[model samples]
Target chain A: MSEKNKSDMLRAPFKLEYDYERSTGPIIGKFFEGLSNQQILGTKNGDNVYVPAAEFDPITYEHLSEFVELPETGTVKSFTWIDQPRKHHLINKPFAFALIQIDGATSSILHMITNCNESDIEVGSRVKVSWSEEKTETIKDISHFELINE
Target chain B: MSEEKKDHFISPISLDYNYTAGAATTRFLKKVSEGKIVGQKCPKCTAVYVPPRGSCPRCGVATEEEVELVDKGSVESFTIVHIPIPGNPIVPPYVCAMIRLEGANISFLHLIQEIDLKDIRIGMRVEAVWKDKSEWDTTLENIKWFKPSGGDDIDPSEYRFKGPE
Candidate 1:
């Protein structure tokens, strides 16, 4: 096609935005507040203890109200090494997003694992949450999980 | 109750979308960029739609027949926006009107300019004003605005589509 003909084609930027705000309700609200105070919390339903505080019991379909304080140290349930990181990823360097089961919690939470080589971490590896210096009651408060040598 | 109120947090969100104009819309926009208006006619109801909707909304059938329409049309309804909203394209006190193009049964909403707000009426005749040829593109933005067509006042009954009986 000619240059002038191609120039005739139209293009414009469009953005879809919500003008309103969203409120994180009670269960998830407490989870965020705990992160702000450098604490980790979980919700308990009978025998199953969920880290990151589930709003309802996944198996029972009942409202979960019991809050369990969990230790920062956890074992990696499963992990995958990312060779190249995308722009949206929290860490620019190669890292792993792993399912980590915290101490005293039966269920695992998905979070980034860093501060170690791809070969140094695997299933059942011990890791601890590296809290961010600046916390604002969001998931980013827990910067990433680092390998516990001991 | 007080603890619940203190724990609540507000989250702000924004999103972006890119829509690919399908075959029917592409054809309609191309014609409009060339300073011509076209509509798709419903085979079942014979109702013509400006901006060429691919399907007939009234009959739930695909529209295939293309019909050229006149630039002049009558305003079916309108609202004057006075509230100042963030990122609003037009200023307050501007008129946004639903115009039923001549020979088309359906109405499309667009900005009505070059007329006083107090003088605007439901059946006021308006014509599409094209932008400079250099700025023309395969988009509806080619039409700068709809101005008064200087035609006689059209009765509401004349532009109203009586259902397919």
Candidate 2:
């Protein structure tokens, strides 16, 4: 601990751990259950159907229980390319995180687009769900979306 | 917005990080390892900050001049915590005080014990109670807590003399 080298430092390891436990309730709980079975479900609000099922109508705010089975296919409405994957990313290689407009649905689902290069995907590119072989009743059941055209 | 209420989702979230102390803070903690307390003086505002963050948060100037401090201090404020901290051995109803160490401009939180809960007050005189020398390390935890030292309590105005907000 000399004066000349007092500034030379060591970093201490810090871990913040806690249990994130809560009830997903009915609407979101049913949505996750649908994913485990490889089913795409949405809620019908008049003419517009929202994927990831909204519990209430967007306009009238009425309780919505009428569910619709949507097709797995979708079109990329907007997207951003990631050249390098970070530790927490699901995909190990370069991928695109795109806002997809699922077919027969009014809104978009933010999902990953993999197995394609930077120029191979765009706003209008068609893609479909690539299901994980091991489903966990969570969002990851849809492993990622793949280019339906290429 | 009410929905169907059932089914529990229990997920454990955790993050591992490395916090490297800055030059000023590293030196301050090192001093605490040797049964001493230190503060860094800000060049612009001239405020002495204990456990310095290497810069003046108010004046936005670098702090390098180090000032060795006495272990004695005054309780600037205090609160009795009735709720127990998870995994902690200390029982609730214990006093946690904001202590401004002698020669330090800012107050820091620390446990105040060895006195009755009713006796705790603002501007009370207290001194650091250190653990055994062999168990010391580069941690402020080396000074276990502050205890009533039976001296003149600092004038309440002394701690309230900081420049304008």
Candidate 3:
């Protein structure tokens, strides 16, 4: 064995692999079931029904059961610019994901915006779902929220 | 908040992984219990891998040939572990290291025993000290630890040990 051989061995590498599972709770479960039925549902907290049901009532802290249908059209209450997206997000490129308060709903649902460039997105923009001809009980089934014309 | 029955919160954090390994490693552990060191050779690149890998990471092909590596090697890098990791058998305040076996292209981690922690050094020549045959299992721990090879302390800069370049 040569001394040179000892120096080179110090930088050897090792590789490992691992598998993981995630748990989805009751709220997300009901949302998925609703998507499977091709209907979006929300829960009424008090006087106003939220587009996406609250897991826990904001004021009362009790479980909500009242479900209601909201119009697909909604006004973007707020949004964040995603110049780079994560692997599991609906869109992989630059997009505006927003919280939209749909008609007949008091609270907003979190979703992504697509089918247009980032420059066109704004806080008051109207967006609608580009529903799949075939739907599943998942948010991804809606493809992405598309900007709607006034 | 009540004085005797106040609100309390509890949080749970844990790590569990479904550890998977390549076929080559399965064979290596099986052989380790028998007090043998095994490696696989990449025919094209000529790099030997201990705890053999299914494919050559550098050449991008399966390493088909199995080679028996020498039990003797030298410490490439080492650390004095003062903190104990849960599930590790050894108590803390021990020395652990990557030992590059002679004639093999990679290093394997194991405990270093029978030496003062302060005396252990990089490039120290050591050889496998195996467990009694009756206690051998499919684990690297079958070899108790690498004991110092009775040779004189060679200069760290010129300690010639076998391994890949």
Task: Give the best candidate by lDDT.
Answer: 2
Write down the RMSD of candidate 1 (Cα, Å): 5.5
Calculate the i-RMS of every candidate, to one decimal place: 3.4, 2.2, 11.9
Instruction: Give per-model CA RMSD.
Output: 5.5, 4.8, 13.8
Q: Candidate 1: where is the Cα deviation over 4 Å?
A: A1-13, A45-48, A59-66, A115-120, B1-49, B52-70, B76-86, B89-97, B112-139, B142-165
On DockQ, the leading prediction is: 2
Model 2: residue B104 alpha-carbon error in angstroms:
3.4
Query: How would you encode candidate 2's per-residue C-alpha lDDT over A15-57 as one tens digit per residue?
Result: 8877776666677777777888999988897898988788887
DockQ class, candidate 2: medium
lDDT of 1 by residue, A54-119 (tens): 999888889999998989999999998987998657899999999999999988989999878999
Question: At residue B1, what lDDT does model 2 achieve?
Answer: 35
Return whichever of 1 and 3 wins on lDDT: 1
Query: Which clashing pairs does model 1 show?
Result: none
Tens digits of per-residue lDDT, candidate 2, B6-60, equal 3656676779888888677777888888988888888877888887888889899
Q: In model 3, where do residues sit more than 4 Å from their true spots?
A: A1-150, B1-12, B86-89, B152-165
Q: Residue B5 in model 1: shift from native, Å?
A: 7.0
Per-residue lDDT tens digits for candidate 1, residues B17-79, read 666566677678889778788899999989998887689998999999999998888899999
